[model samples]
Target: MKRITVIGSGYVGTAVACLLSTKNMVAVIDTDKEIIHKLSKQISHLDDPQIKKYLKKNKNNLKFSTELTSAISKTDLYILCLPTDFLVSKNEFDTKNLKSVISELTELDPKVPILIKSTVPMHFTDEMNKEFNRDDIVFSPEFLREGQALYDSFYPSRIIFGSKKPSLATKIASIFKEAAKNSPQVLFSSAAESESIKLFSNSYLAMRVAFFNELDSLCLSKSFDAKKIIEGVCSDARIGNEYNNPSFGFGGYCLPKDTKQLISQFKDIPNSLITSVIQSNEKRKKYISNKIIEKKPKNVGIYRLQMKEGSDNFKESSVINIIKKIKNHKIPIIIYEPLLRKQTFLNSKVMTNFTEFAASASIILANRYNEELNPYLEKTFTRDIFQEN
Candidate 1:
């Protein structure tokens, strides 16, 4: 079996390691001792059911460690799943961590192939290959969601490899193909094109979200039924009713940052739609906040902090933005999130007792509807048209 080392045991890396361990000897390396400790005991650090099952079933083939050097020495191939968070102040992605990982691996072994699964700016892979003087540095963008990471990996819609070495690219594709349950279309293209594919793909999803949200806003203003309008509009086969759900805005780990990164790339070129997508998302959040302000509640109750259902991530969740806006009005807010251990978040009180939280607020704001909020439906304000995240 092929030996693989996956670096960065976050959402993407953990899922990749579990999926590959089924047919290959995989070692997961991370700087976090707690993450390594949990993985070593066959316990998943992330909140994916599929990952938990696979980690348990493939415990014999999978290994976890905090020692990167030792893991690299034992592995034949390296997959870098490092973070590249977009920095708003710099108007670009902070790729320092990814560059550091590449430097370490090149020093360890220059001949071993390295596949970059981290999201980087366009032409980043090409520049890095030229800098290191190696062609085996491939850029394969990940398309997995936050909670459904392993499920998407097991049944990927497409597999793309960005490499100058066609033979090496084919071999890398073969490895993923062998691991996946279904035969996904594999495409080998230039590093720049592949990078553009990821950015544009996420940007399009953000745009669709913005489009439906704008429609909902117009319907609300006109006192029309948004659900009926959306149903009739989505009836067109070309539209194919999906992702038409309204929310505070499109805020997640990928969409917000990826769309901003793509806009940064349009520095020289004149474009309105690309720039408007970012503005539209912010406007949607502001519109939602304005609706909350119109209610003029003494205390507002936030049902959950997550961006969507089955996800523990709240990095850039739209509900957080709404909370910030509402805070500016000097209104008391209490958050009810079972996942939050802290008593206070962002200077607002976090209520562990759901009954007390519900009684304290005159109105509640929920980005996505849940059954737990059923008793307080009359006091709850939500824009979840499809009732699914």
Candidate 2:
């Protein structure tokens, strides 16, 4: 196995770092000194219990640090798993991290094949190659849930590389393939085309979510059972019945930004719904907040701010947006997040004790339903159609 280095050390980077450590000597380079210190001790800053276990088991091969020189000097392959957040106002993804990592990698070592695992603006790879004067860099997107990052790494549905050098791409793909639990789809392409593939893929999933959400919205408006309609529609084999669950909106690290980035790419193009889908998500968040507000509650409790179960991410969690919505409306907010060790969330009281939160809340707004709040089930307001999200 070849030596591997992962930059960023967030969810994606951490997952990739741990997974590669199973077969290769892996060192994660992060600017976050605290995170580096934790990883250095074979401990994960993440709340996931499984993550810590993996860190313990793979302590021999896994190492982490804040030094870029040591990282670049140690590994021939560097994975740039930096943040590529959506620029909401700009309607594009901020590829500043990817750009900076590529430049840094070149300054460190020109021969290292850096695989960009961060999502980017379409044609980013094309422009980057021209700017940096390197053909060794490649774009390989990651598809991982926040909480199940490592598990997904071991069982990735696909491993795609955006490199014209099919032979070299195959070598990179082989690294992930050996570590993967199942057969992974390894496809090669021009960096520009691959970047488009990642954006368009997420956009399509976002569109699917929006489609089902509108269906739920229509059902709610007409007092029709959403479960019945969804069941009937998904009964068709053509639909395949995945990503069909409805929610306040699609808000995570990827979908929300990816859809907007793709829409921005269509600047001169004639499109209405593509743009409307983005608008609809915002409208949906507002609409849900309004619906919860009509209850005339005194103190509202937020039960689990996670985007979905088994996911530790809340980067653009819809529930946090709900908190922002109710803050100025005179209703005091308390949050019950098992993942949090803080006394508060943003500014709202963080109730580690469910009993206190449950007793004080006039109503609880959960983006996704959880049975843990069953003691105050009557006070809960959620649109969990299938109770899956």
| TM-scores of all predicted structures | 0.98, 0.95
- Alpha-carbon runs more than 4 Å astray in model 2: 88-91
Candidate 1 runs further than 4 Å off? none
Clashes of each: 0, 0
Candidate 1 global lDDT: 0.90
lDDT of 1 by residue, 1-389 (tens): 89999999888998899888889999889999998999999888777899999999999999888888877567778999988899989999999888888888999888889999988999999988988888889999899988899999999989899989999989888889999998899988998889999999999999999999999999988989999999999999999799899998999888999999999998989888878988999999999898888888898999889888878888889889999999999888889988888999999999888888888878989999988789999999999978987
Q: Report the C-alpha displacement of residue 155, candidate 1, in angstroms.
A: 1.1
lDDT of 2 by residue, 1-389 (tens): 78898889988888888888889999888999999999889878876666778899999998788987887666869888888877767667788777887887888888888788898887787687779987777888888777778888888877888876777777888999988888877777877788888888888888888888888888877989998899899999999777798888888878888887888898988888778888778888887888778877888889888888877777888888888998879888999887887888879999878887788888888778877867777888878878885
| Candidate number of the best TM-score | 1
**lDDT values for all models:** 0.90, 0.83
Number of clashing pairs, model 2?
A: 0
Q: Give the TM-score of candidate 2.
A: 0.95
User: Which residue pairs does candidate 1 place in steric collision?
Assistant: none
In model 2, residue pairs whose N, Cα or C atoms come closer than 3 Å (at least 3 residues apart or on different chains), thus clashing, are none
Quote the RMSD, in angstroms, for model 2: 1.8
